[model samples]
Target chain A: MSTNATTEIVPGWETVIGLEVHAELATATKLFSGAPNRFGGEPNTNIDPVSLGLPGSLPVLNEKAVELAIRVGLALHCRVQRSVFSRKNYFYPDMPKDFQISQYDLPINGEGWLELADGRRVGIERAHLEEDTGKSTHVGGGGRIHEADYSLVDYNRAGVPLIEIVGAPDLRSPEDARAYVSELRSILVAIGASDGKMEEGSMRVDCNVSVRALGETELGTRCEIKNINSLRSLGRAIVYEARRQVDLVTSGGRVEQQTRHWDEAEGSTHKLRSKEEAYDYRYFPEPDLVPVEPSDEWIESIRAALPMLPRERRRRLADEAKIETAAAALTVERGMDDLAVEAIGLGADPVRVLVHLENNLADGIGSLSAGPFAALIAMEVDGNLTSTQTKTVLAVLVADGGNPAEVATELGFEAMEAEELEVIVDSLIAEHPQDWLAFTSGDDKERKKKAGFFVGQIMKVTGGQADGRAVNELLARRADA
Target chain B: MTEYTARQRISRSEVAHVADLARLSLTDQELDAFTNQLAAVLDHAADLEALDLTDVEPMIHPLPVHNVLRPDVVGETSDRNEVLSCAPSIENEQFRVPPVLGESP
Candidate 1:
């Protein structure tokens, strides 16, 4: 059955999508121990007895992980109720502890909504907290383990606190699913809960995709694509998997429910396992970790502490700062929106601040290190330097941290007083008599052009110390006379 | 106290699948052993179902913490020599090890 070409239409095709995104909580220590939660350490160096699952080492809940989890739940509009930790019982060499301590039936967060860019809202089923497993590097050639060599395990990431967000089958297309995941990551970053770095395995996503007949009440058989590292890969995997399923169904064949691997290089999904071959995991309550009950006051405090989320802050920037949605999005995209606001509070013009942040700062300093750039914008807005000189001062600040004023002074940006600017303008008009005569004899447009040239010369001679606005006013008054 | 029973048990084959996804190597015997052990452990969780927990609230975290954040300051860690001394392999002020095949030089 074919429907509208612009819209998705298949006689019996409805895309069912759900996401299980695991975001590594930004904490200094592991979820159940004091082991550092840092990435890229000497293999297994970040481990402790508790993280390594040594006998007699009991897991203590990291207070920071819980706070971050609550902040995440609150940001997602999830219900932060009492939740219990259960052992997702399974034996794996990477899972130092054979059982993964996670929350099952009663998760920490339940039932939230994420508003998509298309103005569509998707339901968040549940977001629960758990610890991460160790990293395993498969050894030998051809990239196949069965062929050869022993695997080396790195426990650096093991036991890091992770919050897994599960979404309902509300995503209609791959694009919508991608947008939802992106927004979710942005929200997590904004709330200061997770780094949301997909490349570093800090944030991971698994997509559950299936296609059913249009107007069908029953859900279609779904296959899960695991560990999608990037947003681009996620959308590609969904499209490829959905089309594969549709082809299978239309050919009078059943689409097998399984976990598929997304080969980002090959741009296809390879069957990892089938449902019949899937693991039971045998989840049970972890005996070691006690159940956690957050007080109502604690939950409220976390809720109040949540910084402005990306969507809300984006809307506010658009309305209050009169910035475009895209510009507003850039400010919130990198967790620099707060710094931008702080810079504005320190006297930066909103429009110029947005422009500087989006164009110059984003390009020169990089989004992650925009702190000094924001400070430079504030300095310029405070009349410490001209806009041109602010760029120079910013470059110096990034290359070598120094006081903006000192750097500006060192670079010869000491501003000229109004009287000094008047002197420069008077000299320029006197030095260029031909331009003055042309300005007096020409039409309004020609006169304005000549006046603009004279103002530019004055600014150039003053090393941009002559305030352009004041110089322009002086030049206009002199030219009109 | 209520006695627990095992239900929805996982099989040895399922454990092996999980191990494969996790890039772990487990012998059949080890899989079988873990399956049985995990099943027994799950049996104990059945006790949670029997508890009069309807009135008892579920707890998510132990501590009542909110906004426990550090200032975004990049502080210096211990000296490089002090840190690199712990590395099994080190060269030129950096930790060096076997190169990952697909990683860039």
Candidate 2:
């Protein structure tokens, strides 16, 4: 990974990177068809005639796809202007439709910014909406395309809406590129735009990397690495490609601009094809589908419906809840930050609730919606149950869905009156006379600690019904007397 | 007749290259026919450019909608038999298809 830093090529070489990340929108149906948008389905089972690209099958826009696109646009802080789909004229066996319906000149999202962890902001050139092609699986020996006897095509993913976000050539290193992709995925998931699962083909990235002399004005020959599925692979590919380009240039060999394949095992990019010039994919407006214009009112409604993004929510959790930054980050990372806030809103002490969630409650609950557990915490905070009684109530809540107060009553956690607690404190002080004497004496701080020990024992005897704060105050008064 | 002449910007070679990248095999005659047809289409597009579209924002989709989100509930659809019935091949309750080159062994 430090190959670039360790070996300086040409005194100073700067690496420039740009990315095109395709994220399948988390919708139930295909972008331009009624076919199901599901992964790992039986081949062709999710397909409809439109997705199969049959003749006379006019594509109908999926309203859900457009909504997801707009949600992404708003999350990226892009200008979601009225956009149009154009036919990217191309023919592929995988592409059931000869042309991919994609946005070209007028993308749905334009000119956004993504801030990386290192505080560097990468500009988003455009995020266009497009339909995905079908999958082609090559059959027969060694998985080689030429050696394959035949290929099978699956239309399950066909016509699925994919938002391709193109980033500017602002990423200087592989780390920045990976961080940019990671942050983008988080934002998409936060806004309910996409699942952003790279393994399931819900999110994928293609990186364009180039290396040029530090002071040079012209960019180097850039190579585009296709379909890097994971962030770790993305970082490795960028590093390896940058190093490879630098080695070629420094060795007096010309770096060929081309599309390359990232061999995950080899940790390098092998040449796939010579770089083609900007494709005049003969992008023209789709004649069949009408262009859509979102009204001002509609756009405003979407904006209003937008949830608090991860970054904003993290800040709010840290600021309002007075939780530690790391703890707040853990909540967000686990996708439970919203649940934490909801639990707090229901009257749980934010810090205590976070601690309980992290330490005790998280294991039993498979997901973040620890509803009854949250209710138990709220009950504890309300002084209706002690912390120990709350734990038992939590156990019952996890076992069965019943009222926490009722469970607390079954376990004898009903709160005691102040007068009853006062009597207990009085008796405890009378019994522990030696400790009370030391507590009254100004010299014995250690004995005063023993006095606190006796108070705790008295409260335990009272079945934790005595409020600890009130017990302490009563103990202090009796000891001084 | 409108005196609009469509400019042919893309050559035959470029069309062939695009087709190859997309992994579709087209005959020579088909390529030539598509080139001319695409040129005519572009000419019509040029006419659209002449229209008063300065204030008319380009529309992307048909409807005005936002945040059409589904609750992240795992829906009750685990019918593997129904799904695998459509596959050309299946093994171990999974869809079996022709392997692609460059995929990991």
lDDT by residue (tens digit), candidate 2, B1-105: 222235466678877876776677999878887777776777778898888888986555556653333332222322446655755776544445554444321
lDDT of 1 by residue, B1-105 (tens): 222234546767777876776668988777767777777777778777788888875654555543233332222323445555665865444344453322110
The complex in candidate 2 yields a DockQ of 0.12
Encode model 2's per-residue lDDT on A1-481: one tens digit a residue. Answer: 1123433333488888899999999888788766678898766667666776767888777777777888888887889886777888765556666788898777878888876433356788888899998877767765556578656676678788899999988777776777688889889988888889999888999999899887676888899998587999998898888888888888899888888888787787887767454344767788777665677787788989999876677777776678655457666756667667777766667877777666666654443354665677776766667777777777667667687778778877777777888777778778878777677774667766876787678768885577666666777777667
Question: What is the overall TM-score of model 2 with all chains considered together?
Answer: 0.66
- iRMS per model, in Å, is 9.0, 7.4
Q: What is the lDDT of residue A269 in candidate 2?
A: 80
Show where candidate 2 strays beyond 4 Å: A1-14, A115-120, A212-219, A277-280, A322-327, A342-481, B1-105
